[model samples]
Target: MIDDELRARLESLGGLDAGPGSLAGVVVIDVTRVVAGPYCSMILADLGATVIKVEHPDDPDYTRTFPPMLERDGADAFSGFFAQYNRNKLGVTLNLRHPEGKVALERLVAQADVLVENFRPGTMDRLGLGHERLREVNPRLVYAALSGYGQSGPYRGRPAYDNSAQATGGLWSMNGPAGGPPTRVGTIIGDLAASLYGVIGVLAAVRHAERTGEGQLVDVSQQDSVLTLTENAVVSYTTEGIVPEPLGNQHPFVRPYELFACQDGFVFFGGYTDKFWKISCEIFGAPGEFDDNPDLQTMGARFDDAVYAERVKPMVERWFSGRTKAELEALAGDLVPLSGVKDIAEVVADPQIAARDMVVDAEYAGYGSLRTFGSPVKLDRTPPRARGIAPDTGEHTAAIFRDLLGYTPEEIEELRAAGTI
Candidate 1:
């Protein structure tokens, strides 16, 4: 049971008057490191949850060592990678390997609405702080376990990283050029997708706990999440004995819906739809020939390898070869939906991205205002945002100990001396 002092603190902290935004009163005990789990808790923090990020005293989150380090006070400090994901959370250190440290975490859990971790299966159970044990501390606490594989299954015990998850989850098989070696998706989709799913699960569990006062486990597997994004690959094979192979920049079902080289760079066109295809034909000044050709009349027919290579590809390439990305974009509209394939820099400077507030500047102590991604989930009233800078490792340890756990300064010092925190 939560102690009287902690209960009072929780009440005060949970009140809407305590802060602004959607999740003002909720508290999260984030025992996650690196990408998947940290990203999930970061979303909660952005939504105004008081996320206390707990790390071990001896070994902190590995991302803290990631590059693009910033110097603070003339000393090498701050990792840009860690800052990008860990912002807007309180940092606390506790050596969970120690008995006192485990007890300290239990106290924090007693007052938290959520606890998220990405350790391997049974890691928490071995520490004697598994879901069942934590439920005893706080019946309404949502436990979100984000891992490479789910808690149950043959592969549950296997260790995995983003690349491994992607490789095993079937994403690698469908990427890259046809008849070429399988390629990984450019980014860490495995970890990021799992993080997104973890966020959904956490929110749902939190809502359920709010309604029935019964908390549940949110098990998000990177492999499973990646598999869901395979986009009909599974059914395509199962339903019709056709295994999907890599198609490079080409969409499997849409002709002229692939990347095309232009004067300067590339542009992606989606003129496979009949309306758009006709408009494209007219714009390219080949309306009569394309519209009249029986072989290229329909999308399925245009998608045929022979038709595309023999008739469509030559004409499309000729049309795009002389035009710049800007020129192609100028000709694009509702008639022929198209976009320039932009690099990261171009994407960062895009007008649409700016208008949508997809990028915002986050001010760190040493780094004045580094640009970072803004929340895509916009609310008219309680908008989610990166509310504040990330806490230094254990920066809020004393404060959290004093306010939430009612620990005296002397007690905190003793724990510190004992290497428990």
Candidate 2:
């Protein structure tokens, strides 16, 4: 039960009221920690859904203290990564190993339209929050499971991270420069890709449930999601019996599709088509060489001739060496596809990102001015925005129990004293 003062504060802040003309009625119970699952829930919360993030009472989310963690009020403040992924969420803590905690969670689930979890395959079932158990309590609930592998796969029980998934899914095998060792991408591509796929599956399940009044499980595997990005490599191995190797920044099958050095940094150039290639050659003042070199005439020939890339690199470098990033961009105009490599600072300061509202400020009581990435999707009629900062652990526990579960103050106090929350 919420204290009278807290209840008054919540009421004044409009407790459980749907945002105007929004998809605000739906509730999302996020029983996930770390990047992938929390990121998915954040997206839903941005879309006006009420997302309640459940954290472990004892351990909490380790990411809360990840590097770039701020220090505030004597405790290690929330990491920027954690805050970014968990924005617009209400947070609560529960020791799910306790029977009372599980009972409270079931009560919460009964009111939720969706439940997302990213534990290893059998963890939820062992916790008695499996799909069958959940659906029995609320048949309309869409259960989305995000894991390293699909529920029934041979590797389902194996531990995985972004790098592990990238390697196992054949993504790392086809990355890096030609003749170099397989290199993993700098970003957590596998985890993020899986999260986005999980989002799609959850929404699809929601739509189906709305139509048929039945809910089902949506399973998203990081390896499977990353595999979608390795389309041609998989095809090459299967259809042509070719073992694809890393081509660095270059396309394995397309010539002149790699990054070229510029005056300051690098510029990626891809002229796959004959027309684009002609334009690129003309821009570089190498039309004669472009016309005469038989190896450079076709993508296939250029790919086959290792000497072709070596010959063209110097010319391309010279052309870019004389031009600033802006000048080169202006010269290329709309005809040539080129982009300057942007570091994190450049990306953060980019006008296009600001104009598109890809960053927003959320208030953290302990930490002022929490700036983080915003929702990318733009809905015409129901645009999404960051609602609030991530809550402190168990911040909304008593309030939610009182308002949604109708628990009494005496009961909540007993649970708290018993260390159930």
Candidate 3:
């Protein structure tokens, strides 16, 4: 139970209400640990949802203990991995195995607008907090499940991560250079896609609940999300019996659609149409035989990677190796679709990124300010912002127990002593 002093402190907070965010008045319970589910909830929090994260002191979320922890008051305060996704939220420790803890979560479920989880198919069912039971508690609750395969598939119980989803969903077959062993994408595409899909599903369900007072399950599968991205390949196989393979940066249907090296930088530009291809030949000052030949001019001829690799690419390379980036910009960058490759440092230093607020500062009590990414969505009247840095493990347990759930001081104390906070 909270002491008298703590209760008084929480009561004093009542008069300091914050201005609402876009998702204002929404209550979200985040029973997620790692990337996909937490990322979905983080976006919700940025849009003004009051997110409450659940964990236990004895067995905290994996991110909290991962790495790069800040020392505060002689204990691990915040971690980079945890803070990256859990920003703008409350936190509470609940030993769900304990009777009191389960009761507390049930009470929370009854009041929540949404509940997100990333556990295996039967885990929540075993914990007695499955979607059906929670729907009984609050029919308007939007229950979201982020998982590998899904809740009712043959692979529903298989343990998976970003790599597993990428491999199984055919993303591995579409990345890297030709003839190379299949490799996962550089970024965690599987996890991020699932997160965005989860957000879309939840928002749709919430809208439905508002209209009909009927909630529904928003099921998101990482493997399924991966397939959504590789839809072109799926279509190709279905209609034409062609299995798409990695051709590095080359476009299969378009000629001259590849990266070309300049003296000072790397540029990616695709010249496909007759107009663009003629312009490309002129810019490179191709020889008469090559520039005037109709046989080599069509997209079909240049579209073959083997033919282009052997006959035409060498001439373009020699021409590009002699020109500076500024010279290329003057010649083709303006008229052609092109972008210079940027490393992380260059991307952060770009004027456009700063003006768009893609990076922002995050400050904490114990930790000094650090620069991290900001929300990507932009709203003219109600832009999203981080509510605060992430909460430490169970940081808001006391306040939430008394202020939100209406648990008495004595009961809170009893639960605390019983390891059921």
Candidate 4:
């Protein structure tokens, strides 16, 4: 049964917005760091979970030390990496080696709904905080483990980062310009994909826990996430016996899908369907040239680059180059899936980006105002909102200790004196 008060709180953004963000009242223990684990926790935090970051006393999240830090009075207060991923969360430090610290974390786990970690396969077990032990304490706690490889595999114990996952996964094998060297995707898709998968798995596990009071382990591999993205390439090689190669900017299964040169810049066209292709042909002043030809008329036939390049590329290129980007957009933007290639400057200044709140200003005391990307998912009832700037390291330690653990001031001081927190 839904608690009306809690429901009201979740449905109203705690008086901040139209609705309380989804996942309100959910408690998340974020023991993860860097991209995969931290980014996942970040998403959960964005959805209004109470994410408490658990950092090792000796060596906390290195993201805190990353470059491009926020300086206050000539001292680094926070890094851009930390600010980006650790917002809407509390920060705390604990030495798991200490019995008191370990006990405190176990208590936190017993009360938490989710726990996210991204260590090597056996690290948590060695630390006595493995999923099995934690589940024994709280059966309904969702435990998500993210790693470069899976929790059980030949490469499970090996350390890996974004670049390693990208190189090992099929993404690097299939990415890059056609017939060129293997090129890495510009973004850190390996880590980002792992975070997305982890989020999905966590949500599912949490739902399961709610129904059955039985938590489960969610194991996400960065390599597997990256490999999942090479679906088309893998299918081509395994099923059709065709070795895939990278084709620069051109669609593997569609004709006239690549960027074409215009007078001022480049324009992209994804008019892959029959009607779209016909429209494109008419726009290129080659109306009847491809309408009757099966090779150009059908999508699969157009996948053949030789036919497309010989029959269609020159004509489209000539037509595109004859017009400026603005002229081409005026002529065809609404007719087809088309856009002029935009540089970073143009993207930042794009009105569509602004209208969608993709770019917004976030103000911090030391940082003043920084432009950041807003949440992409928009819920009709509970829209996501940035709570505030990220807290300094262990900034909420005293409050969390006093409120959550019922620790008296003396106990808190003792723990701090003993280096247990």
Highest TM-score scorer? 1
**Which residues of candidate 3, in runs, are more than 4 Å off?**
1-17, 68-77, 274-298, 323-334
TM-score of each: 0.94, 0.91, 0.89, 0.91
Q: Model 2 — which ten-residue stretch has the worst lDDT?
A: 12-21
**Model 3 worst lDDT window (10 residues):** 10-19
> Weakest 10 consecutive residues, lDDT, candidate 4?
10-19
Assess each prediction's global lDDT (C-alpha) against the native. 0.85, 0.79, 0.81, 0.80
Best by lDDT: 1
Provide the global lDDT of candidate 3 against the true structure. Answer: 0.81
lDDT of 3 at 114: 96
Superior by TM-score: candidate 1 or candidate 2: 1
Model 4 residue 230 CA deviation (Å) reads 0.6
Structure candidate 2, residue pairs in collision: 176-248, 177-248
Ranking by TM-score: 1, 4, 2, 3
In candidate 2, what are the lDDT values of residues 213-242, reduced to their tens digit?
Answer: 898999999999899999688778889999
lDDT of 4 at 394: 76
